[model samples]
Target: MTASYDAISPARQAISSARRVVVKIGSSALTSLERGIHSASLDSLADAVEARMRAGSDVVVVSSGAIGAGLAPLGLTRRPKDLATKQAAASVGQLALAHAWGTSFARYGRTVGQVLLSADDFARREHHRNAQRTLERLRSLGAVAVVNENDTVATEEIRFGDNDRLAALVAHLVGADALLLLSDVDGLYDGDPRKGDANLIPEVRSRADLEGVIAGTGGVLGTGGMASKLSAARLAADAGVPVLLAAASAADEALGSGRVGTAFAARPVRLSARKFWVRHAADARGSLRLDAGAVRAVARRSSLLAAGITSIHGRFYGGDVVSLVGPDDDVVARGVVEYDSTELTGMLGRSTHELPDDLRRPVVHADDLVVV
Candidate 1:
């Protein structure tokens, strides 16, 4: 079904039955200028989470607001524009943010564990696997995992763009059944909410639901806007995780399944964690340029043969992530290369029959590839 906004979608039903969930709170929802962090919001959130946990659902919180919380302590009136300043703010704010969350949850007898992550942590397979173990262990120990991006150490190029995307990836990492994105806005509006004449959309079954729907910019203190939240929702849905986009004030109702926000249905099938990592997290070490026939072949889910490659760029080892570029220089796909750049250099444009037995294998197997 299309995103009619009122349908009883499978994803909405999935939200009510989700045994494990990831709730992402935006910076605007958690902090303000008068108070670095909102204590009442934290208390309300803890209550909702506690209720969910009591109902057999374990919760992971991916939150933003470190920079916002730090603004008060650093005497900054607004978010800093410089990288060093933002990092400095994050270092200070993260500690304060964690402390507030711990204290807030502690009142309800809940133990909160802070997990700070960088893009590198999710990009590297070993680190990603380790992170999974850590979060699982935390849940097993009966602690709530509160995660945030490692903003202090992140540079412009390495940043996750916004916590919205980070939260979506975290949902995939923890095998979450549902993802709830909390923002200042109540739900996605058909028109600009600020300008009126808008209607709240209640459901999205696919990316087509977002067509002609323009999203607004973020708040003064937050980095992610409605656009980013929509992107996060789409990402999580693509990974077979349903999503709920709602306002932070309606946390209790949203958690209680009051049908007050937009629900995005998950796909029938999704990429495995390892494949998700390769597609969304891995940093490509090199690119393999393919000819027209090879592009068409790869599009048909065929394994990439060495005869398809015209040339290579950059240094990469076996099992490393590589981009499959078309003749037009567009990246057609990404995959785990079977051979090193050096090993593949000599086999370019040569058929499997013409190559040595050791090099006769497909350059990249279909299982390791994902079409973009």
Candidate 2:
């Protein structure tokens, strides 16, 4: 007879057995226009997280609601369009948001630590490590790290835009085994959930599973929609972390039972730490268009040489991350540029033997390059 243990899929088992998890709650799930931050929803979330903690699992929460919570209190009926007004609202709402989270978690004898982050935190290696250390320290002290975008100071270009992607990045940074995205929608669907014919998708094994699905944006009070959630799911999945997407109302069931949402199975292959940082963490400062030969060489894991560079786009200096673009304009890889754009302009299409001793090095060293 065949040995029998549990019939649960590995993805489902991952959810139930996750030791450290990242739970991301969206604006719509945590707040309302009329009442501002919803205490009941937060309380329920705290209950679930505390239960996990009691079971010796560590939990991190990436929450969105600062602007939404600030809207009603600041006399704004709708989300502000102007950057200044949005920032002002976030400044006011973040305090209330943090207070609500702290109070809710306190009910279960748990403490919460608020962490505000910007895109720069993840884009820069030193900053990323610092943020990771802070979060790890907080968890070591048995406190839930409640994270949000530093919206009051973040510019449009540097903003995370939504917490979904931030949560996925955090999952990777902290080495989380699972990520739970709690939103207003229960799960991904074959079509728009607003339509009656749509059916909830219980599992997503790969990107191919979402071929015909239509994901819509969030409501008036939120920034992300189902599309962002799916993107976040795929991001975490690529990092070998399983993800569960479910409605906030089903927090307990989704986290504990692992039976109420769409579970995305993680990719089997694991990326190197350096490659993961290069692919997911570093921000590209510029792009280098490569010749056909250069593209072929890069595909074979070779260093990028000035002789293969056809053109460069944008201005960047040495030590900055840059995209390696193919002749067809697709980004084939990314790496830390070894030469400034202006310096590279003088050296392009010239072989290393023809260059001065100091300029003979690869444009991007093989150790720094990561295939996309």
Candidate 3:
């Protein structure tokens, strides 16, 4: 199940035969305290990516090093803990990072298209489509898309580790065949890699493999820990995209040979992008508490009717995303509701035949629903 360059397994074959791939470079892997942006590593990575593209893989790179790069320039030796300082550093570092990527890729006579995104880009339908088109356009023109988070304009919330999750979203957005996550560490370990007894996990075939694994925190220079990488890997893998988690230093070996990292095999049943969005992207405004029968119906991909619902939680308008919760209080599915919570308050536990004509419609349609 490991993605070795020389391996011939399904996961390895998928990586080797992938036509479109998303490569994510973490901040700790791309920058350092003493040198700021790691030029040698960046140059080498650009070379590896160029070689990969020439080998017929369309590459999209999601990079995180802006804050790390900005630290040295601002005379800061460590990553700033505060949001304002982090944003200020990113404002300065993004320019240097974009320039570095442009220069490195230029050596191969390839142009780099800088794309800075926020969470909204993937959550909103219009923004997602526009970003998708932009990335596709860049790839069509033989330009490498250097995608990063737009931390400069962020206010109220600042999550430095979100780039890892963004990379997963990008993979599904572009219908990528594989996702390569390059960070500071080479691969996942059963325990802390800093310990002598910890063992490298070569493959993750299912959730069972990660049952007791502790996902450590982010590194000194970057925010995404092994847990974040694992979470991102699962997102792509569950959606039928193969994933490889490796170190930036091993970019050549990992990209070219498909060796030197843990491989997450793509699920046999691929989740459609729309369903994937519903499962992972759609924000639930409200919830419907369903009976056991409704849970079974939802799991079977049936339309959620009012008769099976016990109660509604929260206030949301019609057509908003709502969570379908079972009697156990666990969300069983998520979908667009057909009626407002206020309107549905009276409709609970009533069959369509018992309700008035105007209020007899299904609460949520099957097509808009996805079982969790």
lDDT at residue 18 of model 2 (Cα atoms) = 96
Ranking by TM-score: 1, 2, 3
Please give, for residues 1-372, the per-residue lDDT of candidate 2 as tens digits.
111223567897998799999999989888888889988888888888888778878999999999999998998888988999999999999999999999998787778899999999999989999999999999999888999999999989999878999999999989999999998888888986565777777889987899988777767888888888988999899999999998889888877878877889999875666777888878899999999999999999899999999999999999999999998989999998999999999998999999999999999999999888
User: Which pairs in model 1 have colliding backbones?
Assistant: none
C-alpha lDDT of residue 149 in model 3: 89
**Per-residue alpha-carbon lDDT of model 3 for 82-155, expressed as tens digits?**
88898999998999999999999999898999999887666677888899899999988989999998888765
Candidate 1 wrongly placed segments (more than 4 Å): 1-7
Model 2 misplaced regions, further than 4 Å? 1-7
Q: What is the TM-score of each candidate against the true structure?
A: 0.96, 0.94, 0.94
Better of 1 and 2 by TM-score: 1
- Candidate 1 lDDT, tens digit per residue, 261-315? 8988898898887778778899999999999999999999899999999999999
Candidate order by decreasing lDDT: 1, 2, 3
TM-score of 3: 0.94
Better of 2 and 3 by lDDT: 2
Query: Is candidate 1 or 3 superior in TM-score?
Result: 1
Candidate 2 residue-wise lDDT at 329 = 88
